[model samples]
Every structure is written in C-alpha cells, then in structure tokens.
Target: MKKMSLLKVDKLTVQFGGIKALTAIDFEMEEKEILAIIGPNGAGKTTLFNCVSGVYHPTSGEILFDGESLLGLSPEPVATQVIPRDRHAEFFCSLGMIAGTAERIAVNLRLFQRTEVSELFEPFGKGQKGSSAMPHKRNPILAENITGLARTVRSYVSPALEDMVLWHERDISHSSVERMIAPDATSLCEFLLYRLAKVIAGVEVDEARIRANMEITQGLVFSEAVLLALVRSGQPRQKAYEAVQRCAMAARSGQGTFFDLLSRDPLISELLPPRELDQLFDLNHHLRHVPTILDRVLHKE
Candidate 1:
C-alpha cells in the first residue's frame, strides 16, 4: 500500500500582478518526513513556503495539509494595545480559591512528570537532577512543596469566612483570626507565587514526548466533532448520539480506531463520506480557529 501524504501541493502557481513567483510546483510529504528546499535569492523559496503556510494564496491549483484544504485562512492584522493593571482592595476571604488555581496546576505537574506517564516536564533548578538516588529521575519536588504551602494558605480561609458570619464588629475570635491569618496567608501566597515562578522558569520541556502524548487518546478526542457532523447530516439527535457512543465504546474496548469504526458504520458511512470523515478527525482543524479567538480577546469586541 502507498503511504498517504500528510501534505500535498499539486500544480501550484503564484503571481504578483504580471510577475510570476512560482509555477507548476508539486510535492508530497509523509508524516514526520523532513524535506528542505534550498535556493538562491529570487528563487521563490519564501513564496512557496508562504503558500503552504496560508500567508499567500495560490493563483491556481491546490494545497492540502493533513487531508484538509489550506485555502481561505489568510488572517487580517490585529492592532496591538497595552493592558493596564490596577490596585484593588482585598477580599482576603476568597484568596484561597484564587491561589488554589496554582495548587491545582502544581498537582497536575506533580502527576504528569511521573516516569511512565507524559514525562514531559522537569521543574528543577540548574545542575539539579531532581533525584538524589536515581540519576535519570527528575521529580517535581518543587511543585509538591508549592502544593503544601498552598494548602497552608487555604487552611486559614475557613476561619476568615467564619469570621465574616460573626455578629459583633469587634468579636475577639474574629480579630484574633485576622491578626494571625492576615500576615500568614499573605506571606505564604507571596512565597508560593515566587517559588512557582522559579520552578516554572527552570522547567525543562520535552517537546517530542508531548507530541507522542497527544495521540495517547487514540483519536477519541474527535468524537464530539463527529457527533455534531452526524446531527447536521439530518440524522435525529438521539440516533446520532447513540451511534457515536457505540463507536467510542468499541474503540475503548480495543476493536479499532475511532475513525475506522465510525466510517465503517452503515448509517455514518452513508451520511459522511471518507473525505469528510478524515477532516473531522484532525487536531489542526480545531487549532485553525485559535487566531480568530485571540483576535476577539485582543480587540475585546
């Protein structure tokens, strides 16, 4: 069987007014295959690359990336602006939950950096191997420390909230809790935030492992897209829902890939052909909308 091309550019042509930059360029690349194009000045190298990147549209022919057309994605330039910060009065009672987000992230890092699992991060300092006994081990001990500190900060939150419910304005219990927790939570939060910054700054990212982990779900992530597409194809909502659920269950039970099972289903095969089915299972398809979302966030419209 011939290997499928991850990227295919056929009969590509580009022109700027009457000057032709490129003509009749054709190429096919397999997944994980690297190909370098070398050329001197005015050889249309950048133009060809730009065409594939969706920066410049081809005057003729087609460009397909991972089975999806890379056409009509040229983005408009978004203006840049500064975000100003403001000082606000404290609601120290709720500080636990806010600082708890850091705790949540630290907990994740603590788990994900385990040896056999994603194993994608090591938030250790320079010359630190993260382990004293195992030379190859790099544990998230810093994140673990941060987690303990965040827990201490949160321990004071209950007292603070209970103090809010007290009847007297000058309750001795409330005043005592304030005098103790005020400095403790504030100082601990400041220290945790600083240590978290340091740990993150010293983090070592394993990009290859991250990419391999992206496929750990066995294409199950695209099931929602398939479900919606089936509903759009005139199938009843419950019918589509049940069909998709069955396929997903089969995939989990080690039958086959999610896409293979969905495409082989009689009802889904008739509604969504192989081409549309291939498009639905793409990760980059979801990522292509990120720029537009960032535009909205920046413009705040």
Candidate 2:
C-alpha cells in the first residue's frame, strides 16, 4: 500500500518590495513524520514557515493538507492545527538584564564576605549589630538583601516555562501568568541593579583584612608555584607533583607551614635554594601580571 503525504508545500515564493525572501521552496510531510528547515539568518527560513503556517500570505504557492488546497484559508484553523508558540523576546531580554545585574551584585557580595566590617569605608552605625543579643556582630545585610531579591527574580522563569504549554490558537492560561510575571520580574531586576549600584558605591574595601586573609593559608596556596619551579628545575613532573602534594596536605592538616616543609625536603632543596624558595612564595610574584591583565580588561586594548 502507498501512503500519501499529510501536508505539502510546492513552489512557494515570497517577496517584500524588491527582496525575494523565499523562492521555489518545496517540501512534504507524511503522517507521524517530522520535518526541519534550516538556513542562515535572513535566508527566508522564517518566511517559508510563516507562509506555510498562515502567518504570512505567499506571493505564489500551493499549500495542501489531506489532498485539499490550504491556500487563501483563514488563519484560525492553521494556527490551531499548528502549535502557537510565544517568542517571549521581551521576557528573555529582561531575564538577561537581570542575570547580568545579579552577577555584578554577587561579585560585590563576595568582596564583602571576604572583608571585615571594621575595615569597611564606613563601619556599621553606632551600636548596630547582626544579632539582638550580640553587640559585636556585623553582617553584609545589603548584599544578603540583593541575593534574596535575585532569587525571586530567578523563580519567575519557572512560570514562563509553564506558559509555553497553551491550548490551541493560544488560550488565557499564559495571559494571567505573563501579566503577573512580566512587570514583577522587570521591576525587580531594575530595583536590584539600582540597589546593587548603591551598595557598591558605598561599601568600603578592607585592604588590611584582604592582605591578612591572603596569608592565612600559610603559603599553601603557592603549591602551584612550587610545582612549576620544580618542573623548571629539571625535576620530573610526577615527582614534583607528589612532593608538592605531600607538603600541601601536611600544611592543610596543620602539620607544618608549606614553606618549612618544602625548604626541608631534600629533593626540593637540591633544586631550589632557600632564596629561590622565598622568591616563589612572594605574593608579588603571583600578582606581577595583574596590572597588565587589568589594563587589557579595562582599556580594551
């Protein structure tokens, strides 16, 4: 038995002024079969789909379904037969803006997390504390507030996804959902950006605390430097890695400082002397290229 195509488009053409959006496009779909049309931007892909789906009338075409001409038919049937999908460009665009704002806020929040309030530009108000019972407490309340609000903004995406499953020709299911989520999501994102800007502008960075925290690891953070130094000093990579790993683990478990362990190790001492080891642990050695990286990022050169 021979089966006939369920839907067919033959010699479809579309033109807008002098622009021929689609030309001589032809395709067919059988029952329970899927078809995909792919093309670069502005290459008439949307035009062909629109014409076949009844969103746009083609200049010359024959669209048939079940052996009947579908040309010049009302759009309501076509729209119902084919699924109606919302592009939601505006909602997605707002989401992107919100994500970017949230990312910036997260960076600022992390800065506050790593710093002490005493080192802030302006410390907490007189007698202000995080807990009612503890008078010496200080919290990053502003950053926490932004984090909470960002969660609310992110949650709106769920309802947006739910809105995609509407009944034929579109229904009122997504209407109320959009009405609630769109304004709330956009406004919340704007509020977060504004509040984040204010927080960042007023927050003071504690350089002293930053420096102290950087040294809290007792030089274990420089294990990579030691490994590279060993490699550069003609030690086999596996041997150097095992040597650095032992030191790092010992330092992490409060056994000894990384510098002391490496300096005492016979293998490491043979290649890198005390002076060379000292040079490797220097913070400036790691941050020496920061200025160049900053210039490239900020100056875009």
Candidate 3:
C-alpha cells in the first residue's frame, strides 16, 4: 500500500544575499517514518530545520504537514511552549477558522471584483465550469466549494470549545464530542487545507488589470499621502484635511485628475508645488515600508 505523506517538502530553497543556503530541496516523510538527514557541516540541514521551526522563511517552496501548510502560515513558535497538550483539538479548531478566512479571501480574489475598468483577479483554471454561471459565464467553483468546506470545518470549533467544559468528575460528554468531531473535523480540515493550498498555488495576478484598477479611483487612493505632505508643509490640520477632502471630492465628481485639481487650488498650490505634490502621489510612498515588513515576517516577528 502506498503510504500517506505526513510531511512533504517540494522545491524548498533558501537564500542569504548572494549565497544559496538551500537549493531546491525536496523530500517526503510518511507517518512514523524514521528518516535522517546525513550530512557534514554547512549542508543545509540546519537551514531546513529553521524553515520547519519558523525561524527562517524559505525563499521559495512548499512545506505541508498532514496536507496543511506550515510555511505559508505566520509563525507562533511561542505558542508551542505555552499550549497544553489537551488544547491540540482547540488548536486544530482555530486553524480551521483561519483556513475558512483564507479560503474566502481566495474566493474573493478569484471572483476578482469588477471595477469600472477591469476585473482585478482570476485564479481559476480553464477547466472550471465557468461557462454556466453569471461571472462572465465563469464560476469560481473550486474556490467556492473550498469555502463551503472551510465553513464546515469552522462549524466544529463551537463543539471543540465546548468540549473543555465537562463536569468536574470528568464525565464522558466531551469524550463523545471528541469521538465524533475528532475524525470528522480533522479529516475534513486536512482536505480543506490541501485544497486551499492548491487554489492559492494556481492563483494568477493580472498586472495590467491591477494597474488599471488602481487607476479606477483616479489617484484618490493617494489622498492620505497628500494630506500628510500638506501637514508636513505647515498647513493647519483642519485646513489640510479640508483641502485634501475637497480635492478628493472633486476627483470623484469627474473633475480633472486629483493632481491637476490640487495644483489649481490656490491654497494647495502655495502649500505644495507641482514637483512636491507629484512626489506625494508616487506609488513608492506606500511601498517604502515593504522591505521592513518582509524582514519582520521572515524573522517571525
């Protein structure tokens, strides 16, 4: 009989600057499989363990635990220290709830909300029977189905939480709940997780659509940055807020682009010249903190 995989790693890679700490490592382990990584010093064994323990983020790859992803999840290494063994079911229940949220996010992206200019996303395969539905005749069947399964998994959380409230004599009420929910929730959750992973893997981003949709709001998205810049230039808070809001409202009302309207406004013109105002709307203003955020996440902060 073919053994079920308890742990699966595919195309795992880790890089540090110009050095590759691990390069496309691949392996699988079955339940109770006694496998060892036999290697001398600096052979990436430590790097692999770091990846598993959430100390390091893999540069690229997949790591599945009982068909659910460990690497894709944000780490809570500290929880392992404090969580009692009995809370394993609760942990699984919480994981199910998280997976439900994740699955819905995936569904929304695949459904790819339509904007004035374009649909923002499409993650489904061509094989999906989108032809029969109203979504441009394309249905997000896979993502939607996974969402339903995720809700089923989330349903178990209530009972699992209640399972902790048995009588002081330790009656078997929780035991019976465990007997039924344990297998059902776990089996279903594992399947749900595996399917969610597949959905996320197949997701595709439409750069053109994304950029186009970003323009749908006519640069009003940068209003906050404009407001901040106005304040930094010594504009009073109420005055700056009103100026930015007026410019935003003008943009929404089909006035010329937000920048043009702001430039024409006498007060805004004095506070923010074209060059300075232009800089405020640059997309990089929002992305400047990405590297720091990435570093924190990679370090499990």
How does each model score on lDDT? 0.80, 0.78, 0.77
lDDT of 2 by residue, 1-301 (tens): 7666899899989989998998888898998789988878999888887887778998997899988887887655435543454456446556855765776666566555643423443234566676688655567666666777787887788777777787665678878887898888888888877777777677777788777766788887889999999999999999999999988888889988889999888899899999999999898899999999989998995
- Residue 289 in candidate 1, Cα distance off native in Å: 4.1
- Could you tell me how far off, in angstroms, the CA of residue 168 lies in candidate 1 after the best superposition? 4.7
Off by over 4 Å in 3: 1-89, 111-123, 133-136, 298-301
User: Can you give the lDDT of residue 157 in candidate 3?
Assistant: 80
Arranged by TM-score, best first:
3, 1, 2
Which candidate number has the best TM-score?
3
Candidate 1 lDDT by residue in tens digits, 127-176: 97766788887778878888999999888877766765443333355667
lDDT of 3: 0.77
Error of 2 at 167 (Å): 2.2
| C-alpha RMSD between model 1 and the true structure | 24.1
Please count the clashing residue pairs in each candidate, in the order shown. Answer: 0, 1, 3
- Highest lDDT model number: 1
Ranking by lDDT: 1, 2, 3
What candidate 1 gets wrong by more than 4 Å, as runs, is 1-90, 165-168, 289-301
